[model samples]
Target: MSEQDNATLIEVKGLYKLFGSEANKHMHLVHEGLSKDEILAKTGHTLGLKDINLKINRGEISVIMGLSGSGKSTLIRHFNRLIDPTEGNILVDGTDVMTLDQNQLEQFRRHKMSMVFQRFGLLPHRTVLDNAAYGLTVQGLSKKEANERAVEWLETVGLGGYEKQYPSQLSGGQQQRVGLARALATNAEILLMDEAFSALDPLIRSEMQDQLIELQEKLHKTIIFITHDLDEALHLGNRIAILKDGELVQDDKPEEILLNPATDYVEAFVRDVNRARALTVETVMQPQICRITADSISDALKQMRKTDDDYGYHVTDDGYQGIVSQETLEEAVRDDNGDDALCEKVYEDIPIVAPDAVLEDILPETINADYPVPVVDEEGEIQGELSREAIADVLSPDQVPEEAAKASQPTAT
Candidate 1:
């Protein structure tokens, strides 16, 4: 109803849930009426989630993580109303999930959202194609149309030829593929995946993770994935929420969570993250810049030679824009002086990464480019510079000594 509410696809406010003890069942009794000692004495129950407040953005993958009994799974299950909250509101695109009647809940589950479970909940009696189309069939789709959609989704999940096979006929990985296809076939805007790959072997789990990423790239569906695996959480979650006893310990982008953890609990989860691999030059790019055109290669080269940052200099049509570099300057100078249409041969179409590009993406582009790549904006305008070495520090943070620490140390003390 409000602008803030519209920006949030899903919102939970002052949520509280406690198990056991009928005398203290209500949220108020649990959250406001009793202290922790009193609740333990009366209910002999634990708070599954305590005053949990969250907002999931549209078209983003938000991960919920914690150890067993931490409520990550419970919280995600609440999104589609699989488990009704004991208290507080679960709003889906502004509608209150708690208020949905059985029919409304069923319709919401069938048409508005779809979920993938860790167990790969496929019907053993059904063929892979039929399993994949189960959701569509449940919604009253024609068998022909449902099967057709199933086939298309099966191919997308790399199971095109396995359509006729039953769940028992497939491997664990293959069965999970069917589950993924089934969830996808509904064409829902929001997807809830609860440890969808946890049952697989490590190798298969990694492969499934890649598949999930590729699928997300194509579909851009908003997703909330629940996993206890820290690596998987980092790899998949655009933003992560670390839940401890149902309380939110941290909610932030992966890089921020790693670099600026809010609590010891969250820090332990991020302690081993390869921040370089998880980040991009785009994350650290500076905005202040000047632009020049290719026609003024001489002038651009001169400016680049004087600049100290990774941004060599920006290049544009009317005038040059972005960061420039010595390598770029020399390349431009040499090419400008050369005879054969050097301008066409020298410029590139590949996106120049920003300073924020993580070392993982940077190293490959650097090795390929043989120099720092130009950082560009969404409009394809050169903004600054991104270098292999700058990326290397992220990749090899241990090797790169802290300049601030060095500068601050007492001389020979």
Candidate 2:
């Protein structure tokens, strides 16, 4: 795909929505700082969204989260023009959705986007295969072609061999799989899931979330997921948009929301969040580090003696070489028989982590580990190092976790 298509698939500018006959006329009250209740009492209009400016990037899950009546559901419907905005522009792939006529809108929904409903929305009389092929059939594919495409997606969603079963015969999770298969069968560029797993059992919901994540890795479809649950949003969203009383309160990554909530309401939502699962190794790693390019064991030992720390990273201009402890170099200087390779690397087996690895995933590696963890990028180059002390600080009850927005970026000395 072109870079432009992958940047921002949807962009909402100056968006506002209110439920009343004269909703557009009452928008000035919202801009004047009138609360939702006040507007309802004075203008007889219930505000759904007000001045919501957001960008939903391609190939990422952008979650819209809010409590009941917070307009999250209303906002999502506006994407496909199911509910028109009272005021503002909704741009999808650089085309204003409001400008599309009925025929154009129908074609847009069929080709550009597909939705998975929360209630599974499966036709009861149809078999699983027919239900899964619903979208393809709607798009005018023949039964033979639609069924073949649906079968592949059904298998992909782990519902293989159940094509003949009716919706009533399958479990809730299985029925949801049918819904997901139907959405994926169309091969649309965008997937809209509005609280898709909220009705299932807790365990089933968790499993579906995992499956969705796995599917996203392979398909890379732009997804807009709606959920009220903070845990669900944190788990699924690459970027989260939190709403309160129809106004956007916070829009940020999960770690930023946890570390530095934009408002009190957002803070309350993330107050009890487990830091280990939400944060990654990238946030805690110190990238601005000292590296020694020593050519000899005596030279390496002399360089290490100047630093107060016990260890040093041995790296060239290209990338990381290895780590050397002052004690190891001291021993090497005394024991080396004029060997040139002595200054190359002290230990071959050291704990290392990827920048994107969650802290929880790498917690066990740090336990009783004598060495500092090296942070490596995807290009197999070392970017930074992580210390156990840094990990403990965030986990400590007495320690105030560093501001995540600041911590995630490199600090200039």
Candidate 3:
């Protein structure tokens, strides 16, 4: 992509959608500050969306969330021109979608975008291979080329050997995988998923969410996901746009929406979800932390003593390897080993997690660990560490540990 395309792939500007012919005739009533109900009563047009504006950045998951009538699904349809906006325009890579003629729009939908629907949208009689290859075949690829790409994507989505099975033969989750593979096989830059995982069972839905995140790490397609579930939105979205009664109420990163809700309605939604599910280790990890190598036990002990600390994280050019503690230092001295170099080999690959592993994803990993859990990035770089004490401080500001609070105060700005 060019620099401009990288910034904002899709931009929605002052969009409005009303479900009635001659909707423009009712624009004056909308400008009169009428509510959705009032506008409907007066103009006989249902207000699907009102003045919605959002910018979807390249290679990021942008989730639009709302209840049934809040216009979440309605807004997503405008991106592919599946349903044109009643007023205003949408821009894709700075090209106004409204300016595209029938052929241009057809090409745009065929090559530039692919959509996954709530109902799976698979042909009942077609085999999984045929369904997955349908998008590429529609673009006029040869049977052999389309099937090869379809086979690759079906395996990518964990449906490797199920190529000959029909959609009805698969479970709801497996069928959804077929839907996802079909969408992915097209290899469109922008992926529109309208409640793609909503119909699955709860456990299956969670699995699908994890699969999407894992796939996104490698592919990084510009994804616009629609969900009414707040937890799903928080787990998947890089930035969330929340709608209430067809108007965008708040647009923010997951943490911002949790820590500072823009309105009472947003606050109400946040209150229901336990914040731990929405927050990851990256949000509250302590970045400016003690870094000690495995061979520096004596030096590390001195540094920890000066700071009145018991633990230190070990990192190298290869990035965060593991952690060390005072107990390990004591063991080192008791062994009477002058060389701490070989001690590194003893416990180089230790993975520890905690008790409430299912109830809450992050907190237990911090609380149950012998020391603070190190926060590693996608590339295995050490960004910071997350601890029970810090989580406590965040949850109960009035009872902050003085040392932890003091250490983080500098970066509060």
Candidate 4:
């Protein structure tokens, strides 16, 4: 939904999983609207997943979330073929996972995918460096080369000096950092994180989430993260899939899910979420049509009159200069001053916000600003303007965009 390129990395099609001796015989019962309780009561089969179809884009974080028995953990295992589906196709980079031979599956897991578990799965006897290097060592790399790679990743995850320490010596957060270092040390393209931060305390969990986001900006690995927490899902997932009773109830971008919930369950999940934190300036920014160059006093006044606005943004070839007021232009004309003198009258102390900044952070600046806050990029080029009205529109539930409404609809498999 965030303008992803037409490249799908993982594709799960018509996936179903049933746990019982005679699972195949109860397929018809599942299709006939039988509940999970009824299915288990009658046939002694536990349905782990049903008709699960998803397309995970390359280098994006796809979070699968649900409650305890919602099948989120059961669903992620299918990605690495740790658990085989009763019926479905698991395609990774266009290769069918189910068709892989034992050796091929082993190769795939070793070379292509690296997993970070809820529990710190580091070897007890191994030092942090040795644990981090384990994956590379298993792949037949020399000790020197593997340790070098592991050290680099360990430093990246903020554990440079702790390489000599054992897993028992580290705190839960630090141990998870080691686990992350180990996964990153492998340099695998696909990262499978199952409740990776759920084991940490709230503060540590939040820190790890921030660390992962920062790392993802550079690594760009295709990540499949599992979580039962909706807030965590919304924060980390580029796309979120909600499961209920072993079935996919909804899948969409987080903003779409928040703005236009597809079902009552999703609505309840989003009801208390802080909308200001979820919505970015890009979602509510208006076009910067009222703009003028420093030399164009006449043009500035005319444009302000046309837009019925008192201020206009003054921009130079370098980037944003400041805001120009109609009163300043009028006085400059009355004094018959030159363009240089008029340019000096432009107010350069205007409030500004980055396009990616959330509304919660933008509120303080906009609330006290005399004019709409200018939304600029890294280059200081003005992209749009965020007015109070635009912010209100975004907060209004009925004013959600039609595109977002359509995006919230379930994908047809």
C-alpha lDDT (0 to 100) for residue 381 of candidate 1 = 61
In model 2, the runs with Cα more than 4 Å from the true position are 1-6, 303-308, 315-321, 336-340, 343-345, 348-350, 377-379, 396-413
Q: Among all windows of ten consecutive residues in candidate 2, which has the lowest summed lDDT?
A: 398-407
Span of ten consecutive residues with least summed lDDT in model 1: 338-347
Residue-level error in angstroms, candidate 2, position 230: 1.8
Candidate 4, residues 45-78, lDDT tens digits: the string is 9999999999999999999998899999998999
Clashing pairs in 2: none
Q: Rate the local accuracy (lDDT) of all candidates.
A: 0.75, 0.86, 0.82, 0.86
Instruction: Write model 3 residue lDDT over 311-387, tens digit each, in one string.
Output: 66666677666776766766776776525652454332434332223224654445655567767666767777676
| Candidate 1, residue 249: how far the Cα is off, in Å | 1.4
TM-score of each: 0.80, 0.89, 0.80, 0.89
Which is the winner by lDDT between candidate 3 and candidate 4?
4
Supply candidate 3's per-residue lDDT for 292: 68
- Which candidate, 1 or 2, would have the higher lDDT against the true structure? 2
Q: Tens digits of per-residue lDDT for model 2 on 1-413?
A: 77755698899998999899998788889889999999999989998998999999989999999999999999999999999998899999999999999999999999999999999999999999999999999999999999999999999999999999999999999999999999999999999999999999999999999999999999999999999998888888899999998889999987788778899898888777787877888877786365667766677777777777777777666677677777777777677632455444564356778998988788767543566778878776888888766777665353323443233345689
Report the candidate with higher lDDT, 1 versus 3.
3
